[model samples]
Each structure stands twice: as C-alpha cells, then as structure tokens.
Target: MSDQNVAARTRAALDAGEGILRLAPTWVPRSFLMPGARLKLSREDLYALGTHRGGIDERWFSSTTPAANEGAPPDEGLSYVVHDGAKFTLRDAVGAHADELIGPALNAKYKRWPVYSKFFDNLGPIPHHMHQSQEQAEKIGLEGKPESYYFPPQLNWTGNNFPYTFMGLEPGTTKEQVRRCLEDWNKGDNGILDLSKAYRLKPGTGWLVPPDVLHAPGSLVTYEPQWGSDVFGMYQSLVEGRRVPWELLVKDVPKEYHQDLDYLVEQLDWEQNVDPEFKANHYLEPIVRTGSEQEGFVDKWIVYGTVAGKQVFSACELTVLPGRSVTIKDPGAYGLVVVQGSGHIGKLDVDSPNFIRFGEVTKDEVFVTHKRAGEGVTFKNTGSEPFVSLRYFGPDAHSDLPKVGDYLKVG
Candidate 1:
C-alpha cells in the first residue's frame, strides 16, 4: 500500500470510531507449546491453522510487532483496525500518523508504536528460556522483550496441567551448574529444572519479567503486556521428552557466536537469577487507583513499575457495577480487552463473548488513542453484573504509575 493511502485510511478510521479504533483479534501460535484452550477460541479451531502452524494459543492486541515464528506470514503479529468493513494494519497507521495514534513525543523518539500486549495459554509448561536483552538482540537485528504477566480471574478459572512456573535459578545455584546443563543438552533431561524453584500460580496477580531472565511459564493462562519484540532463546534442551534443537538456543545469536558457550552462558542475568528476594521484587497484585464503590466503579493497576528505570509499559483492571457508570481518563494510547461482563465504552458497543470462532469480529477489543484518553471516555455497566476490562499502555504511557512496592500499601 502507498504511504498516502495508509495515512488517508488511518484518518478515516479515527474519524469513523471517534478516535477509538475497533481492533480485530490477532492470533499467534507456538509450535513447541500445547494450547490450554482457555482463550475462548473454539476447540475444533484451536489448531484450525493445522498442527503444523501449532494451536492458536495466543491472542495479541493492538500489536504492530511481527511474530518471529518460523513459518509466520508477513502480517502475522500485527493488529488490524476495522472501519466501515475495511481494515488496515495498525503498523501502517502508526507509520502514517504516529503523532495522532500515540503521541508526538513518543513518535519522535521511538519512530513507531514500540509496545504490544497479548494473552498466552499453554496446557503444561514451556522450557526455561530468556528473551535477549536489547544489547544482545541488536546483533540479531531485533529489539529486546520486557514483559509483564497478569492472570485474569475470568480466563484462569481452570488451570490445566501444571499451574506452577519455574523462575530463575536457586539463590545458591552456580553458573558452572547451568553451563554444565547446557553442555549436557543432548543427554535426555538437562536437569536444569532441578536447579530452579516453582512458584504456585495465582489468578488476579502478575509479575514483571525483564530481559535475560530465565523462566519456564506454567499452565496458567497469562495476559502479557510487553514491549514490541519477539526475540528469545530457549535454554532448556529437553521439554517433556521433546528434543529442543540446539539451533533454537542460538536462534538469536550472531552466526559466529552460535557455538560460543561462554557467550550463551553470559546471556542469563546472573545477579537477577540469584536474587534471594525474587518474589518481593517481581511479584505484583492489584493496587486500587483512586475512585470508589460510591462512584460505581474502580480501577486497579495490575502491572506497573519500570525495567532498569525505563518506563516500558503498564496495565489496569477496571470494574463497574450494574446500572452504574463513570468517565475514566488515561495519559496515552492503550489497547483494551473486555474480560468479564461488558456494556459500553465511550459510544461503542462492548460485550465479552463466552466463545469465539476464528475470524469472528468482536467488540471485545479496542484501541484508545492519546487524545480520546486524555479527554476521558465514559464506561457504563448496562449488564446485570459488574463489567470488567483489562487495558495496557506502551512505554512511558503513565507518568504517575505505581512502583513495585506500592501494592504493599494497597488495602
């Protein structure tokens, strides 16, 4: 498409939806992981794209980043803005009008919308892996990934298989031990899991995972709000008797460094991996952000804080009681997914479907622009029950966002 055409389409989309873009659902799958099937996707359609493409276990929102899956189409991870039955990739819109979609300051610095969010469901556990840091990924011509995971109560009613995630290495675990595990890649189970501790997964809770952090996410379905990148390297060679090729470990490394064990071992964040108070540092729980019961609504920050002092992203869980309404405002552009009951957001019709088929158009997700958010949008609970939603922002979106320890003070 021509740049002129994209700009014209972006303008039309904003005008059509009153600055709120209705986003089509974007599904992504991982060949190595089993689907938990809690993402409301139809069972028969879970592997609708075929087992070769893997099960549709992830639903991405407001995304402009491309998924790095081996056989992914060019537009695989990009979100599409639907307007009057016509659509265009959000990437093109950002490329056309970043100032209007995000903000002038953000556009000037990032040159694009640099963050995205998604919901990932897995039946069992993934191999322990670390997303390369920006410095590391630069060698592979990609950006680093710093993500936060919030387990929505609505989607996690059933924690299939294993609900425990193995994060980081034991406080006393040595680098030589991990190096030995890497050396024993083809020798059945590398015994890496034996050096890690599994934390019981809890719904309505979340954790921030920085780059180079080794984590094997368990069976709980997770709503991950993250930076716009998909570069990662799986450290574990065997996951449940499934042989993870050594090439997977060096997928992001430069061709020359592919066989450098020392370089690979150094990719793990040693200090973070050995942190004794890991929970106190990375654990997150909902912290109410003003408003109240009398106001008929409440908004809580489920994901907040910075990575390396850089504001990467943030998220909030909102709830409004039946027959009640309130106007909520935010600082920057954000994408929202209706989780529980839903009624109205702004002038748009909203509903949380119990089941969704592939290619189904849903009002369950939308992208709120910077202007519309600053002007505030009214949310109404027209349903019989409380209406709930999860919304997340891009980098530096919230200036007054809560820090890691703020949840300790929430009542």
Candidate 2:
C-alpha cells in the first residue's frame, strides 16, 4: 500500500475504536524466513502462548537485609527478628525460575542489560522533587549551576507525588527513545517534570509505572522495579541557578510516541490528599486488593494501606516495639526499608556488623533483604521508641490468584 493509503486506513481504524496494529510471535528462528518478512498475530494468541510457553518467572522484592547477629554480650536495648510474616527472596522465589515467568523472546531482550534493584528512600518529612535547590541536589549527587550548558535541576516530591521511572523491555524505536531519555535525565541537571501533573501516594502504597508514562511518587517513601533501562523526558526545570528553555526541551520530545502525554496529564488527581483518615501529617491512602486468584501466583493492591493476596509483588508496613521482632516464613527475595525510628534485623548481637540499624531513615539509604525458600528472617526495634519498616516481595510470593476489583482505576 502507498503511504497515503496507509495513513487513511490508520485514521479510519482509529476513529472506529479499532486499528490494524500487528502483534508478533514471542519466538522466531532467525534463519527460518527471508529478511524483512512480517508475521502478524493477535493479542489473544500472544497471551495464550505466553501462558503456556516456558518462560522465566521473573520477580522482584525490596527491603532491608538484616545483619547476622553472632552471640555477643546481649545489649540491654538490642533488637531482633521475629517469625510471624511471609519471608522470601527474589533470587529463590523468582530469579531461579525467571524462565517460567518471562518467555524466551522477552528474556532475550532483557539479556542485553544487567538487572539491579531500585529503592528510593524519603527519610525526611518530605519526599524528593525533580526540581529543587542545588543544596538538595548536591546531597543526592546531582549538583551543577543552571546555565545554557545544561538542563535545570528537577525536584521530585515523593511525599505528595507518585514519581515513576520506566524500562523499555521490548524492541521498538519508541522503547529505545524512552530508554535514552531516562539516561540523559539521570546524567544532566534538568530532569523530566510535569508541573500540570502530580500524584498523591499514601504512605506505603506503590504501583507499577509502565513505559511511556509521566509519573512520580508523591511525598512518602517508594520502591520501583522496571526492565532495567533508563529513558525519560523532562517537562520542567525550576531549580535555582539552572534553567532550560521550554522550546529547546520540547524539541527533543519524542513526538511520535508522545501522543499520550495529554491523556496522562488529564489523569492527574490533584484534589486528593495523602492523609484522609488520621491527624498524622504523613500522607496515607487506602490500597485496594486485586488479582489474588491467578494460577501459580498471588497479587494484591496496596497503593495505600494493607491489602494482601498473591501476585508478582507484595509489600507491607510494620511497627516494631522495643525488643519485639517479626518473622517472615516465605524465604524469598524481599525488601525491608526503614521509614522511621530505629530497628535491627537477623541476629541483634551488638558486635555483628551485618546487624541492621536505623538512626533516621533517609532517602539516601534504604534496606533490602534476600532470603531463600523455607528460610526466615527477623526484625527487632532496639530504639527507645517504636520502629517502622516497609517490606516488599516479588510476584507470586504469597498467592497465585486474581482479585475482582483489583484493577488500577486511576492513572
């Protein structure tokens, strides 16, 4: 077909709420066909194959890995781990069986990059913003005067915003652009920021940010997992001393793939508050549990509060009292991030260097834990006051069923 004909057909299909987009098979032998040959499939076929194909069951968990406590003289205020909750590690729970979660085609794409854990800490009362002062920038290792030589600094408000980063795990020009954008933002002073948009995250709630979306975690602490690729765009640069022209930044925008930017902007929930149920200044929102009944795994919705089930990822917040400990039994890769107060994990012996300790949980330092199946870890609050921690586990760490009403209603 000619270019004009293709354009007309695309327009007609889009207007009718349908389009002739092509889906490719998950796997293809390189030498099986001629170069540039196209094979079209449907979404249903892809999904069916994905479910049946032997794929890597990839999963991720976030939390503080507690220190091993050796038998040292017991300190009067020593903290310790308890065995009451689920305990698991990504390496054992998901990493070892990644071939079962992600199919061969997708696995090949991921092999191009190294997988690393991503954790964000907001130890202070407020979260980090993409556009903020240089002092804050220096603290986070992003420091430079704003000038024509670089983009302005961007501060991210994790307390009142839902900050998101994306990874393009597929092969496509659009995905490549997204990855490149993130790399540029991370290396420069000015990062992506959308002033007309913001997100409100209740403490302890997190959601996945797919590729090609404008998002940030509002105030409070947050953890993220992605395809291990960096690509993004900076919508605003408001830091002192550094600033870039909007036109210049927009010129670099991936216009072909950015048609959804306006739609994303419209999804912002500006009227919502982080804390709706308590007088505490911390942002708090209710999490909805969804998708807990899928075969082989459990998924829960904890965008704000505690909603448990089976899925690829699970997380919860706990308050440990002095000398109290919580034991996790799942024995898989997990994350233990300290949000407030002080605590210890594993053996609480004072001399054990691996003993987890928290003076003031800051965004710069987040604790992560990795365990094996059937093995357990513990946490104890050794501080004079109560200790708080956030824990995360990989997909299917708990259950393997889907929940009715577990869908993400808002963007």
Candidate 3:
C-alpha cells in the first residue's frame, strides 16, 4: 500500500476508536526454547510455525521491532492493528503517523515506538545469556535491550518444569571461572550456571534487568516490557541437554572479536553482575499507585525503575472490580493486553481468551495513542470477575515514576 493510503487508514483507525486501536495477536517463536503452553494459544498451534522453527512461545504486543530469530518471516514479531475489518501493521501506522500515534516529543526523538512488551512462556529455562549494551550493540549497528519482567497471577496458574530464574553472577564469581566455562563450550554442559544464583519465581512480582547482565529465565509466563531490540549472546553451551551453538554466543559480537574470549567476558557489566545486593536492587514488587483497594479499581506498578538512570520503559497492572469503572490518564502511548475477564476500554471491547488459534485476531490486545492516554480512557468491567490488563509505556513517559528501591517503602 502507498504511504498516503497507510496514513489515511491510520487516521481512520485513530478516529474510529477515538484513539484506541484493536490489535491482532503477534506470536513469536524461539528455536532454542519449549513452549510452556500458558499463553492461551491452542496446543495444536504451538508448533504452527513448524517444529524446526520451534514453538510459538512468545506473544509480542504493539511491537514494531521484528524478532531476531534466524529463518523467521519478515513480519515475525510485528503487530497488526485491526480496524473496520481491515488489518495493517502497527509499524506502518507508526511510520505514517508518528506524531499522532506516539506523541510529537517521542516521534521527534525516536521516530518510532522505542519499546515493546511480550509474554514469553517457556517450559524449562533459557540458556544463560546477556543482551548487548548500547555501546556493544552499536559496534554491530544494532541497539541495546534492557528488559523488565512481571509474572501475572492470572496467566501463571502453573509454574512449569523449573520455577526459578538464575540471574547475574554470584558475588564472588571470577572472570577466569567464566572464561573457563566458555572454553569448555564443546564439552557437554559448560556449567556457566554454577557461578550464578537462582531465585524462586513468584507470580505478581518482577525484576529489572539491565543490558549486559546474564540471566537464565525460569519457566513462568513473564510479562516483559523492554527496549525495542533483540540483540543477545548466550554464554551457556547447553540448556536442558540441548546444545547451544557457538554462533549464538557471538551472535551480536563484532566478527573480529567472535573468538576473543577476553572480549566476550569483557562484554559483561562487572560491577552490576557482581553486586552483592542484586535482589535488593533488581527485584520488584507491585506498589499501589497512592490509592486504596476500597476504590473501584487498583492500579499497581508492576514494572518500574530506570535503565541506566533513564526511564527507558515502565508498566502497570490495572484491575477493575466487577461492575465498576475507572478512567485513567497516562503521560504517553502504551500497548495493552487483557489478561482476565472482559471489559470495554474506551470504544474497544477487551476480553481474555481461553484459547487462540493460529493466524487469528483477538480482542485481548489494543494500543492507546498518546493523545488518548493523556486525555484519559475509561474502562468498564462488564463481567463477574475482576477485569485485569497490563499496559507498558515507552521511554520518559512519566515525569515522576517509582524508583528501583521504592517498593521497600510500600508498607
């Protein structure tokens, strides 16, 4: 379609829903991981993209950033906006109407939506890996990824194989130990995880992970709000008896430094990785947004805190009581996903589905334009259960937000 046509359609979508756009579910696969099957996708459709391509283990929300998986389609991780029985990519909508969609300040700066959220469900655990820092990724002309995780109780009814995540290096871990693990890559089980500590996964909790920090996420349905980049390097040689190719360890490294053990080890943020207060600094608990539960709804900050001292991204879990309604005003644009019950968000009907088929559109996802968010959107719960949804905002969305250690003061 022409750029003019996209712009026209984008405008129509914004107007039709009063700045709220319903989005189609965007499923993403990972060749290295097994699906936990808690994403509401039908079991038969887990391998809908083919077993070789891995299972549909992730569902991205309001994303423009494509998945970095090898052998994936061009639109693998991009979301589609459904309006008037027509569908168009959210990427193109942002491209054609950036100012109207994301706000003039963010559009002028990033020129695109700078962040995306996803539900990544795995059966066991991911390989110990680290996303490149901006300095490291820029060497390959790519961007960094700083992500935060929130496990929602509604989706995490069952914690699969392993309900614990290994994050960062132990306080006294040495670089030589890590280097030795890398050298033993060809051997079965490189034992990189031995140098780390695992925390029991808990639903209704979260963690802020900086770029270049190693992590092996456990089996739980995770709601992640992250920077719009997919650059990472796996340090573990094997995961759950599955071999992790050497190429994956150097996937985002410069070609010249691919085999440089020192360079690979240097990629880690030593100070942060070895911080003794890792959990105290990175772990997050929901903080009520200066309100009481007696109100009609509860708004909690599920994912907050800065990345590199900047408000890179943030998220909130809003739960409207049955038969109640609330109007919320945010500072910027956000992508939303309904996780429980059914409700009316502005003009769009939102519902959490029991099962979603491959290539099917769902009412559970939507995007609220910056203008609409600032003006306020009313949510009405029409179901007997609590209506729950998650909304993630882009960088610098709020002038004042909860800090990393703020949850400690909650009580």
Best by lDDT: 3
Q: Whose lDDT is higher: candidate 2's or candidate 3's?
A: 3
Q: What are the lDDT scores of the predictions, listed in order? A: 0.90, 0.29, 0.94
- Residue 253, model 1, lDDT: 91
TM-score per candidate, chains pooled? 0.98, 0.36, 0.99
Estimate, for each residue in 1-411, the C-alpha lDDT of model 3 and write its tens digit: 888988899999999999999999999999989999999999999999999999999999999999999999899899998888788999999998888789999999999998999999999999999999999999999999999999999999999999999999999999999999999999889999999999999999999999999999999999999999999999999899999999999989999999999999999999999999999889999998834558889999999999889899999999999999999999999999999999999988889999899999889999999999999999999999999999999999988789988988867
**Model 1 CA lDDT for position 55:** 89
Alpha carbon deviation, residue 7, candidate 2 (Å): 56
**Candidate 1: deviation at residue 404, Å?**
0.9
lDDT of 1 by residue, 1-411 (tens): 788988998898898778888998899998888899999989998998789988889999999999989988999999998888778999898888788889898899999889999999998888999999999999878988999999999999899999999999999998889989988998889888999889999999999999999999988999999999988898898887788888789889999988888888999999998899988889999899867889888999999989989889999999999999899889899999999887988888899999999998888999998888989988898899889999999888777899988888866
lDDT of 1 at 98: 83
Which candidate has the top score in TM-score? 3
Give the Å error, residue 105, model 3. 0.9
Give candidate 3's TM-score: 0.99
Q: After superposition, how far is residue 143 of candidate 3 from its true place, in Å?
A: 0.2
Pick out the ten consecutive residues of candidate 2 with the lowest summed lDDT. Answer: 146-155
